[model samples]
Target: MRILAISHLFPDLKEKRYGIFVARQLSEIHRLGAEISVIVPRVWCPGLLRHTERWKNYDHKCPLCRFEGIEAFSMPYLRLPGNFYNRWSGLAAFRAMKSKALELHKSRKFDVIYATDFFPDGDAAARLAKYLKLPAACLSIGVDVNITAHSSGIIYRHFIKTAKALDGTLACGQSVADRIKAVTGKSPLCVYGVLDLEEFSPAPDKIPARKELSLPPDKTIALYAGYLTKRKGVYELVEAIYRVQKKCQDLLLVMCGAGPEETALRRLIREKGMEHTVHMAGEIEPERMNKWMQASDLFVLASNTEGMPNVVMEAMACGLPVVATAVGGLPGAIGDCDGAILVQPENVDNLEKAIVKVINDNQLRADMRIAARKRAEEQFGVKRNAILILNYLRKIVEEKKAKQKG
Candidate 1:
């Protein structure tokens, strides 16, 4: 099967870790004998900011780029901040890439159009497919459906319309699939994100990993790896860490990833006097994440919502116990994952208690560590899940072809 996957979610020259999951998934699908091409839409910025060093990295080289040997392109589209005019952004994305989409279609004759996220990515994908007369499938990663459904407006209606119009929809978790049903009255294929077990496996010795990263080998470290946004509940994490520090001085809270909430998180850490206790490592490359996970004793995600967070699973694959909020598809994803713990969403008191428990109990930690790795190997194998998606996409392509002939 040949697919033209369009989204702004794929990794670019700037943020290599942005949508590494999507990149990994497509690579696995390629290994399964599927041909995939990508068109990552870059959010257009003004001239002043566009020429800056940081913005330069954000800019993708037009025409062609390569991700894991898969052919990919970057298209620029006008976007209004805060996602206010998302519908407009979808139109902008389609208009920007319409010619290129046609050019690729004329040459390779794609069987279907695939999108990473629903709102703009899927919206644009659906439009492109409609224009080129091909089937379209969208992956409903948590936020694209859930966060938009909170209000009933043009954006919400547009999101529903996009989902309904798609030829197929897939979700990272059941909760996200359910939310898609609630909004668009359509069911989506539910599956977890892919993880490279080989890359993320637990280190044979934690002390050596710690030594490589220069992390304190003696201290109990709880790692948080993901975007630093309000939605991620990083503020709540700092608050819980403040309380945890009062109780256990030797414990450390390390946050990784960069986002809009960086300044706010830094201010909160300083205000709470968690200078030494809480550390922000900023953004680390995806290749180096395994060492960071191995260097830590456990993982914590105080997210307000998520589909099935890749970080949680990656940490589990590294044999670190996870303490995350019970929201979105997390409950289902964490199902029987022994080292994973769930606390109420946005509840700092509960989050604090859970973190304290995981850190203080040594025997429990060891058991959880072993259980976590075992769970990942047994349940979340990347190659296996990638084949599932590939088969489903192929099925859709065949069904579309059959209907056309009929």
Candidate 2:
């Protein structure tokens, strides 16, 4: 089956770690026997705060920028005068994508058009599909829904209309799916997140990895990897770490990722005298992330809201136990397996207790490690996930053809 995949969240050379999950999913779908083409909408601006001019220069030399086994195209966009007016910005993106998609449709016929996110791209894809008389599906990953509910007037109306128009919609987690259904009055397919098992595996030598990263050899390491945002509950995780450290002196916390909250987090750590206890590793490369996960004893995410976190899967793939708040699709992803210990969302006391439980009990930790690997191999493996997506695309294509004949 021929499929067109649209996503604006894909990673570039400068931001190699961004939206890697989307790239990985497309790669897996390709391996499953579907002919897939990717369209990544890239908005170019000079600075984060300033929008000067739009440039269309494509960077073809970066291997990391390219998705494997798929023909890819990029639609360069420029943010208009005011980004605060998201409706105007979104409309501009839609126009840019519509033009490129129409041009591509002239030469290549696709069975289905699949777009990611609920805004600009999904809306654009739906419009393009309507114009071309093709089925369109939107795969939402979280922020799209949040933005829609938070926005007003035209943007909210556009999001609702776009969701209603799509042939089918897929959500990363059940919570997201429920929200979509609530808004659109249509149930969305719930596709759990997956990870590359081969790329993320138990480290051959944990001690060596820890040494290479200069992590303390004796202390039990707890890791938090992702955007350090206020909503991510990083501050709560720090407090929990502090509580755990009081009981277990041989404890260390490593936080990896960069965001606006970094400065505030660092300040909190210093003010609370957790300088030696908690270490901020900043942003690390995706390839090197496995080393950090492997070196750690347990993976922890204190997020109050999430779709389906890819970091948790990566942690599980490394045979590390997870302690994450029960929120979004996290409970579904973690299951009730020995691999994970789920606590109530935003509860620092419960988080502290869970972390201490894993640290203190050697047998439990070992059991969790075994179970974590098994779960990763069985449920969240990239190969299995890719094949499922590919098969779904093929089925959709066949259905479309049958409809035409009838």
Candidate 3:
């Protein structure tokens, strides 16, 4: 089957880590016999922001490029931040990519239009599919339901229209699927993200991985990777790490990723005198995540909202137990995996307790490690997930074809 994968969050020359999960899934789906092409819409910034470093890096990006053997194209679209601009931005993106998508559809004979996220991608896909007379499918990764639909804005209504228009819809977790039902009164398939078992595996020698990554070998390391913003509960994570440090001096909290709250987080670390205990290992390449996961004793994320986080699955595939807040699709993602423990969001005391428990108990840690790997193999492998999504896509295409004949 041939598909045109439309996603605005996909990785481009400027941001390689952006929407890497989407990239990874497409690669595996391609391997599973689906011919896929990608359309990544580049957002336009106005005035001084256009000349800023953020926009400058993307200024000279090639219109088309091959990302991991798959043909991908980037098109320019006008966009603005926040919910106020959601509808306009989505329309702008659709207008920008419509011509290219139509041309590609004629040449490649795509079977369907598949969008990776709801807002701009799914919304635009709905518009494009109507124009081209093809089936459209959209998958909710996180933000569309957790942030966009929940907001008291016109985007909430826009989301319903887009959801209802799509021929098929998918959510990364049951919580997201539930939100989709509430918004559009349509049931969406819950398809979890893929875990690359080969890439993320237990370290044969933890000390060696620590040595390579420059992490302290003598300490019990806990890792937190993602944006360093309040919404990610970075502030709470810092406080929890500090409290845990008081009881276990040998414990170290390793943070990977950068965001707006870097200054505040650093200040909090200094105020609590946790400079030595909390190591800020800013953004690293996606390829190097396994090293951090393998080197760490456990993983922890105190995010306030999420949609089946790929990091949790990555940690599990690496055989590292997790201590994450019970929010979004986390409960569904972790499931009955004894390798991880869940706690309430924004609770530093509870977060600290879970972290300390995972750290102090060697037997539990060992059992968790085994369970984590077992769970990844059973339900989260990339191949299995690709097959599930591909089968569903095929069913949608066949049904559409049958209707056309009828």
Candidate 1 stretches greater than 4 Å from native: 49-65, 149-151, 183-186
Give each model a TM-score. 0.94, 0.89, 0.95
Best by lDDT: 3
Error of 1 at 153 (Å): 2.1
Local distance difference test, per candidate? 0.85, 0.81, 0.85
Quick one: ranking by TM-score, best first? Answer: 3, 1, 2
lDDT of 2 by residue, 364-403 (tens): 9999999998888878887776676666666666777788
**Model 1 lDDT tens row, 1-406:** 8889897877765677878888888888888888888888887776677577445444544333256648888888877655677767788899999999999999998998989887678989989988999999999788777775444588887887888888889988888888787766767788885899999999888899888888888888999999998889998998899999888889988898999788978887788778899889989988899999999999999999887889988999999999999887888878557788899988999999998998888898899999999888876778978888888888888888898899
Task: Report the alpha-carbon TM-score of model 3 versus the true structure.
Answer: 0.95
Tell me how candidate 1 scores on lDDT. 0.85
Report per-prediction Cα RMSD to one decimal: 2.4, 3.5, 2.0
Backbone collision tally, model 1: 0
Question: Clash pairs of candidate 1?
Answer: none
After superposition, candidate 2 runs with Cα above 4 Å error: 44-64, 78-90, 150-157, 181-187
